[model samples]
Target: MKKIGIGICIGIMCFSSFFSYGNEQVLPHHHQIQKGSASYIETINQEKNRYVNYGDGYMIDYPSHMEVDTSLEAVRTLIKDQEREIEIYYDNFHNTPNSAPAYKNYSNAFIKNTKDHIKEYENTATINGMKVHLLKWSRKKLSKVSNDKNFYVSAEIVKNDKEVYTIFIKSSRQFYNFEDYMDVISSFKIIEKKGNPSINTKFKPVERKLNEETKEFYYKYFVNSDKLRWGIFEQSAPASFSYLKGIENRLDYEFKFLVRYQSLDVPMPLEELKNAYNNNRYVELTLQTMHMNEENESITYDILDGKYDDYFEEYAKKIKEFNHPILFRLNNEMNGDWCVYSSYYSSKDTNLYKEVWKYIYHVFEKNGVDNVLWVWNPHDLSFPNFKWNHYLTYYPGDEYVDIIGLTGYNTGNYYPGEIWRSFEEVYPHVYNEYMDIFEQPFMITEFGSNEIGGDKVKWIHEMFDYMYMHPFKNIKVAIWWNGIDWDPLRNPARIYRLDNREDVMDTFRQRLKDYK
Candidate 1:
């Protein structure tokens, strides 16, 4: 019966793509480019939506409000799980006229850089807009023999004089034609923002607090504080600067200062890390301690081995050198039987994990890593109290800790959206209680969605929406665990392949620039 049901699901999903890919284009008059930089003209005449405009193009419109970037040189918009991006580059043939042949030649090069899943798919009339040369293709097919394979993908490409664009949409093979029903793809348009854009217009930030009564999500209130609220979000280049401006407008506050992680490659000795923090580049130093001890060994033996202490001494010197606040999270998410640290410290042995936690904290203090702030982070549970005791069972002394953190990820067999919804239902207010007891800043140290669907763009938006509305006032930093072996469902060693998805990376990076 289960096998039959799974087969039926696969069949139905095959038709899912048409809904996102088969629509005609639509261009609004508001999106018209002002006659400047280059000649500008537009025409829109489709029953549903189809429009075309040409000039010094600056902005692009999408059929849906997706995670989008509308910078001038490059434009990208995500529709469901599909991503369409156009990057403009100068073509210097001097007098070489702009033609489809030249465009196809360049397109072929772009296609070559990608996997064989994409082939020259099709060329068709673009909704109500000018004719566009379109090519469609798919990624390597799924195999019945192995669990390791790149997630399936399909793509659409379009080219013109100013830029050459490609749309790479990813999904399981079950939803191969995902773009077929998407309204944005067939009916998208680009236009330029008008007027000499002003130089420095500082923004007023909007604040929001969690509204329990609503039950649903909202982002229009904040905990008013005498001291200005502080936050951290990363940025890239030109677009990143624009995103920063947008954040400033929404928050009405300049960052107190910036703290960049000096290095993520090799483990820093406690001494060197402290020095960097003391210099004031950033206050908090996050220590990853899972690899510091041996897994599957007696708790006493592990501690007496004195491995963790060696690293603590090295790390302490660095923390004291900078006089920086340290966010020390050791053996995070140990309730789950995944890592050597966590698996050995499961719910049954409360004393074991706690004793180890204390030993490390004591070593740090004794070695002068006192300037550091400690955080106790754990995984979210489906059955609230079933494993509730595991959360505080091994909690170390009050003198040794400052913050509590939680790691959450969506883990369903299929449907990323549904998986995310399940997580919210499983552990709704656990963090509020964590803060109440600890009375220190808390954080979602690691959070991400990894079920089955390909809608990474939507996943990011929903996550930010939740972060913007957590009830706890101290729920401060929310870092997406970008570490390679963090996925709970798959083999940890192979998780590195998942990070290769360029679309996922872009969406994640954009959130960092926007939310803080």
Candidate 2:
């Protein structure tokens, strides 16, 4: 039996060597040989036979069967790409069915410390009569142009104790049929060899590193201010104040301003908006809500034409007269595509959008409007793209903008603790990037989570907890999306009136105390 086995092995070696040379006959057309040819395969097989000298290890089995070229470079490249997907998978695994709080904390830390992109990884596994090792993972490209671009990764893990086989597959798609593949993956069984066992290592918790620039920003906005700490907004000024008075003991909240987005000709003209904002009653005021510009399209730039130009001038004059910190958010959420102003104005055409914002700022300056902190509020559409462009489209330059504000209200729409899909993710990344670019203060110009099961209190507390930790700098104000209509666009705002529900009062008071 031993002699027969030896003969068979020799025959296999000769057969492999015979075809491994420069033999185009064996090469497949349309498939260029990277490195592994017949000869290379023979050499690798030879190496495998001398397993007594090399160490053996174990890992999960490859779920699929595909040609795995034995080229070192190809294998290395494949392994380099899969590192992130693998890490994320592992994180999810450990976090779930484990400890939620610990997972959250650890995940945050891991995200902070992750510096390099995936380069490579290797692990061994054994299946039926074979030895498998997860040998490679690599990062193919950066997510620059396409968010949908697959994060390319490759895996070559051996399965079964007898086969000495490997499989390569995409990390993103590999785990889809997780249960079906689990049996194969679990078949990995490592064999002991002569080499000493290397140090056993596992993924560690990552530390959240605060950017130096961002740290300096917080110092300027939150810590530096004594009286003018936080800008507060509400639908009903009187009602909001009663809630404000309740929280006044704990927080130095600023009643920024209270005004409606309607025709400038109503009640007392645009000047009343400025006076209400400046009297120290509030620090910011959104002025004359002009008709949504559908024809020209760009929301920020679609001025109320020459007819309302005088009213706008008069509004500027009032701001100049009072000389108080008032935030002027002209046309907001223009990037949403739903709002008429955003639909028409948000365009790549430079003059198209800039011209409008420029006109507004230029007129305000011409009217000698100072003490007015111009806030450019963009709905947090999404990160890297949506909000960034829309918010910045009609920036009106540095001279005009004092604060960069983002509006994000929690509708009873989304699940609590669930990471928001579009705007939620956009908020952090956008805040970081914008601050890096503009170095100006950022605000949640408007943000509030609606009630679920009449649990608005819990919702508010949770949202506030998130902010208390990762506070945006230069955010002198935050307006709740609470109002009677509850329409996010028209009258989004918090019901902070003294006569309002005591629970509302309690929530505000607690948040103020926590902020302090």
Candidate 3:
């Protein structure tokens, strides 16, 4: 829940198979990996393993099996025992300044991290007149056993006068075939549209250590779960648990997490965090980098320049002290204009945004603050809403994010120019867009229908109706924002509370039966 400017998956709709869950046909996120199905992995010596993607301009002939988990992001994964995934992604990156910092020690998917995470094994070659950077890394989980295997990652970056295309191939050590990456990577060909557009490749492994919060138990649990986890942010604090109890009574269910907001200008709000956790609730903290409305031209850039090092370090330490896992959303809704950290305030350069994001994550990493899962979120709607200001343009890349946060509020017809929007109008398209690009589970970090525009009760029913009709395979959590936004004249304008009326609350409770 944000004051104003806040925003928030390979959403792989992979290869799917429907199985009977009691009276219903259900499709879980982790379907059994098989050949010829949507989890299409080519079988060795099988022609079917070879898949060509005509959407972006590329084609490939993979070995053995093909695994396409369209539910979360990769185009395909490989073989029966072990797995390999191929993803062809296009970054609107012909405009990126040569000066911006990206994920992992200032390098993105195309460049190497060169840090303590992935062991660096780089290969740079000159092909004809083109300088191609082929970054290859073999990352092994550091264990004492000498026979332990490692996964391999390789990628290519190609750009013309338009889009920057990245070809990434990853080999899972589900079984050790060290040369697995070469089988598929060598066969990738970019179908040229113009006379001669260039193509290049590079990739490094993405690895991080957490303080006992294994990715298996936390992230994958959400990714594989079929149930929806509900949450909320009531307007009051300290007494928020009291309000949450009342909200639970109204909704007839318990919340998975309680949302909390904090500004980075202060030390971490350890007290508020403890307050939430003490009530036996998990916490999702949306940490804004600036003191509201005080962010100037230099704030985020100064963060890039190391202005708040001591503050952030102390903050990270406090979070580590909290011990429990937290859904950490930093500078969320970053693509929106209302946020101080958005590119709108930074010379319209989003690289500054990514750099600051990477900077803060590295701080947490350096401090061994591993109980937090990083959420990369952009608002469902952009404020300026230009191509340059698009949500994908602000992505820091996949390696740093564990969850994708979705925030789209039906602000209702409260303020001027705000119109009545159906529940259908708010989510489906935005959720689909993220599914095409990211391989992370999504959470509606905060959203609610205002009572002003139309029937809030009908809106609730429609929200659940759309869910039953279309399975949102990657969405694991949905948090309602139970609060109000005051108008300029200081009146309660957007009444988003679900408990205001008996009918509205009853509608949410009734319709929520199937989803939760």
Which is the leading candidate under lDDT? 3
Candidate 1 lDDT score relative to the true structure: 0.39
Task: Give all TM-scores, in the order shown.
Answer: 0.41, 0.46, 0.61
lDDT digits (tens) for residues 190-276 of candidate 3: 553322111111111245576665455465447577777778887565346776787777777877677778786567778887887
Q: Comparing 1 and 3 by TM-score, which wins?
A: 3
- Deviating ranges (above 4 Å) for candidate 1: 1-267, 270-296, 304-315, 342-347, 382-389, 412-423, 469-472, 483-516
lDDT of 3 at 457: 85
Per-candidate local distance difference test: 0.39, 0.40, 0.61
For the record, the alpha-carbon RMSD of candidate 3 to the native fold, in angstroms, is: 14.9
Clash count for candidate 1 is 49
- Ranking under TM-score, best-scoring first? 3, 2, 1
- Candidate 1 local lDDT, 1-516, one digit each (tens): 001111011111111221121364433322222222121212233223222223223322333322222112111222222332222222222343444455445333324433333453555556435454555544343222122122322222233553433333333333345354234344444444343311111112222121242112111111222121233423221113455444445444443322233322345544444433343323234443444434343333344346445555665565555444445566666565444444232212233455566666666666655344566777775211212124543455455555566666655345232333443443356665554345545566655555354355566566556655653455655554333444456754312122346565555555556544
* Per-residue lDDT of candidate 2, residues 1-516 (tens digit): 001111012222223222221233222111222212211112223111111111233323222222222121111111112221111011112223333233223212211212322334434444454443343322232221122122322223322222222222333332344343344344333433333322111112112222353334434453364322444445444323554554444344444434445434342234554445444454445543444332323223324234447666776676666554445676666555444444232222222344456566767767765445556777665221211133443445555555677776544433334342333344567666555445455566665554432466665666566567776554555665444333446553333232246676577766665544
User: Which should have the higher lDDT, number 1 or number 3?
Assistant: 3
Q: Mark the 10 consecutive residues where model 1 has the least summed lDDT.
A: 1-10
